[model samples]
Target: MLYFSKMDGRRWEPLQHDNQSTVAADFRLRPKRRIVPCRPRSLYHKRSITMATTPRNPRSKSGNKPAVAAPTGVIPVYDSALMQERRQRILDETRRVIEENGIESLSMRELSKRANVAQRTLYNAFGSKDRLVGLVIQETYLTQLSRMKFATAPDTMEGVIERLARVCMHFGRKRNYLKAVMDLYFAPTVHRDTITMMRELSYGNSRPWLLQLEQRREISPFLSREQIEGDMTDLAFSVMRKWAIGDIGVARMADEAVRGFLVLAAGATTGEAQARALRTLALRKRRAAGPATAVEAAGMADMAGVE
Candidate 1:
């Protein structure tokens, strides 16, 4: 036990102590620092025992390791696999919303709820709803285009024409996708990526087939390979755009597109025999597709009225 009391003139007299050296040892001990407001550069944290030996995290505001800022903006992208999955989930939900309700009806808050992503994360991923919609539309266009594989360049002109006709008929069956492609086509400003994609699809995918047509002398001498490709691309787009918006039915759109390509190919055929041969095969194929159902018959009547 040790005890001290004031004696005189700022001098402390020991009332009771076993050894004076114990008092000197007590004087040698360092006092623990009390945490207080730190410099602005350093955040508030538990006061450190050793300032020289370690670093900044000790001054974290939460009294833990320094918090990392969540990622912001579109480009470099999310590093967390979980966050990446969340972003993709948002995109998939957006696509489903677009497919079911259309892009105009999509809402960030509703989508955030559906996708289990915070609204902030969606904004960080896409910048705006329009940008997100544009990406969805582009994905849609590419997906539909993927169904029309432009890889198989056939040896026969009819084979190529048949495949091209099927591309239009594919759209004819998937009226929704056709409408989406047309929507992108008519409004290039909103869906610029889709426009770029369509253009790329037209040339990069279709040109090789046209070149093959030229090599086989299946292209009309009157029209260059360029003209043939351009004419058919424009014709299919024009007809499909009408079909997409319900100006024409699937049957009429397919009829026009297939017939238009046949007429174009007719000009390019090397001989009447080959021309007749291709036209015969096309007609046989059409018959094999079965008799015009009531829908087709009604569509035919509509075409006749228009004519």
Candidate 2:
């Protein structure tokens, strides 16, 4: 059933037809002035329903294509759970490669093979090796932060120092990957970019730990209230670098010395334990340096003056 309708500019003359189809009634030309009532069944029978009221192109006055609105918010298109698992797998493989064969061995192809993921997948997950390493460092920091719990205020400074020492010692003993991470952290400029990124990536994870420690007077007692922050950050970086480079021996000894200083600073607890620990540590460190024979002395003096 076809019906002929006369058009007068933007208006149309109603035509008498014998068919059930209302397609002709919906053949609108001036979209702004035209209004056609549509039923759900009409939309199902003929997909010509206009859901949006906004004109496709207000400026264009005459175009056939419909305008699309831009999407809002940061929405992930990929399967989030699967993407997370894949990302984790890549990070694990990256750490393994760095730990076993050093940072030089960390290649996209090698990581892809180890992770059983394609090169494209790795690229999609982590833009590059530096990014992946940054993520790995971030995850490591987050994992460590999760384990550390802070007290509001330790009874004595010595106890606080002892607890801090135990935490450092335990971390040093556990993480064998510290050496590799330390190497990157102290590497030259070209490699230092990754370390900088790692620091930024881990800022979120570490800030809370520092804040929690600050909430407790335990941290303030060690340094002036204002000086505490700068001192604590320096101490944290120093401890991390030391442990990473196998300088834990000095740190272990320093721990005992720190305890003594804490006692003097706190004026609480007897300084006997700290005193004994410090003496034993000092003697051991010097002895451990081996007999200071004349040959070692001359070599040390020569080397010290060379640079």
The backbone clash count of each candidate, in order, is 2, 0
- Least lDDT summed over 10 consecutive residues: which range in candidate 2? 291-300
What lDDT does the true structure give each of the candidates?
0.60, 0.51
Query: Across residues 25-100, which tens digit of lDDT does each residue of candidate 2 receive?
Result: 5543432256798787965796767776854462323675554333422223556788778777888888777667
Tell me the spans in candidate 2 whose CA falls farther than 4 Å from its real position: 1-79, 101-104, 144-163, 190-230, 246-307
lDDT of 2 at 122: 70
TM-score of 2: 0.44
Candidate 1 per-residue C-alpha lDDT over 3-74 given as tens digits, one digit per residue, 9 for 90 to 100 = 333443233333335653344434322233467965875465666686576554423476666755434333
* Model 1 clashing residue pairs (backbone): 219-268, 220-268
Q: Which ten contiguous residues of candidate 1 have the minimum total lDDT?
A: 298-307
Note each model's CA RMSD in angstroms.
21.8, 21.1
Model 2 CA lDDT for position 170: 40
lDDT of 2: 0.51
